[model samples]
Target: MSSPQRSMIAKVDSALTRCLCVLIVWLISASIWLLGLLSLSDLTMRIFAYGEGWSDVSWAELSFMVIFAVLLWRHTYYCRYFAIGIWKGMGRLLAFQGTLACMGLVIAVFTVDVEQHLGASVGLLETGADPALELGELGFILLALYLAAPTSVAKRLSHSPVSNVESAHTTAEKEFTV
Candidate 1:
């Protein structure tokens, strides 16, 4: 390829790589928010099923709503191109919370009798409970965490102001000395 053509191709390739990386991260964060929604639903259901005179929604629903709302707001604010500075720590925290939520869901699935509450004669086995929802939730959780954690590409993107400043200082000194 000609030099101009090669340069264009390289630029396109880098742009595509950056876009793909960002999309992957955004999807992970969105999945975490979705799982939080599902968890809220389950908690609400449990409360209504067991609580006496529970005509109104309980604190669990409200809390979950607040949590998800805050998450959405944060995701919207931080997922933008200009907001990449805080992504490293934010991604880790989000991944940790998502993993914990998934574990809690697993424990709930195994411990809580879905059949007893819903009158659906479905156990974990036998003409059993449809595990799709649980499986999908787990899949989302795991995949999201995997994407959020630092990989080689992510490490390459990390920026350090101290290192940058030191390098700039050395360059300035060299220019002044010359």
Candidate 2:
């Protein structure tokens, strides 16, 4: 038999070629657009109002919704051509997205003249002259950023290819042939 070093399984994971990353982002985006966003928003509202409670629904409907959500997210990555910037640390994407979300929340609170009571979100943002923003807005902003992070990473990976040597097996396990 050919050495395990030469086995197809060795490269199967790496063979992903960065496209899978793109695929994941698209999947998430689509999920949010079709099913996740609405369902998640509803879920958030419900939880805030009533906390965790059991829901009785047909299995078929649940299954259909899940499948539809997945498919929608998968397809969305293809819809938009996003230019992801330099590839940095693993968690950088999430961090950047989150920062943007926070900034957006601050901007919204300042621009829109509205009265909102701060329950838990007060700790995160100090209120003096800055109009207080609600927790719901913060939650939605977070959700949006969360969805966009993966796609951003994928765009970066695809645009900037890693050197073959850098990608070569660096796993702990070593192999030997007889």
Candidate 3:
């Protein structure tokens, strides 16, 4: 194919890839938000009742989340598409994003069951006047974030370049022209 054809193909692929990446990014962001909400709910419930210690299981869960965050805290491959091209600025952006993700996880973990800082432990959308409604709020927030992440990303990146779908269509039409 000619260079224009090739450029067209590459740009189309890139645009599609960006759309997919945006989706994936939103998914990750949403998951993080959900986890935070879960922690918030747990914290709220345990507030007024008997003091529940961070048992072996809670600690285990915490440690696991902590470790998982640490493991995923990588930034060396953010802007790299298919591991082929590596731009300095893109790499830096990736690193920054990765770091931000890790930081978000850390913040969530620290405030998981800490009710004082966040007001209530449960959510406030509940029907009745529950003292610790923050948990419910947290759940809603978490769900909202996760669900909204993809939408937000898609909306943000909607202006991304159009892929070869149009070009392919044009090619097909021209092929039938003669």
Candidate 4:
């Protein structure tokens, strides 16, 4: 293939990869949020004996989710596609959020049943609210961060000085060629 053809192909491939990564991350986060909401509802019903107990998730299920997150955390090769390969700084943020999510999941699983107790225990900390709820919330927040990190990095880099310079240079080169 000619140089331009090769570049076009590479750009297409990168775009496809970015789309795949975005879809995967978004879907996973959405699923987790849905499942967590369902699980919370089930637990509430089981404890309070009210409402529909749908989507009750067990400890094993949470463990599986943690495992999946850990695996996803390990596989960050697709991050390069974000912002036309300028999101290298986001790798650490992604890794940290993934780790935080995993930790929150484990804590949530351990205190799944006695969330009130967990809250009481941490009440002295004055952190506000139940510890279990906080942990669960943190997990979801981290997942959101993980989901948004790539796009945020891409956006930030797109307006970066380096990118502006590169864009200007490319435009000049094209004009000269024409």
In candidate 1, the residue pairs with backbone N, CA or C atoms under 3 Å apart (3 or more residues apart, or in different chains) clash, namely none
In the range 60-116, model 2's lDDT, one tens digit per residue, is 334534654564354344224343333322133334444445556467685443334
Query: What's every prediction's RMSD, in angstroms?
Result: 10.7, 17.5, 15.9, 15.5
Please give the lDDT score for candidate 1. 0.57
Per-residue C-alpha lDDT of model 3 across residues 30-63, encoded as one tens digit per residue: 6655554454445435433345545423443454
lDDT of every model, 2 decimals: 0.57, 0.45, 0.46, 0.53
TM-score of each: 0.37, 0.25, 0.27, 0.28
Off by over 4 Å in 3: 1-6, 48-178
TM-score of 2: 0.25
By lDDT rank, best first, the candidates go: 1, 4, 3, 2
On lDDT, the candidate that comes out on top is 1
Better of 1 and 2 by TM-score: 1
- TM-score: the better of candidates 2 and 3: 3
**C-alpha lDDT (0 to 100) for residue 83 of candidate 3:** 43
List ranges where model 4 is wrong by over 4 Å: 1-6, 49-104, 108-178
Query: Which pairs in model 2 have colliding backbones?
Result: 26-73, 26-77, 27-73, 27-74, 30-72, 30-73, 31-73
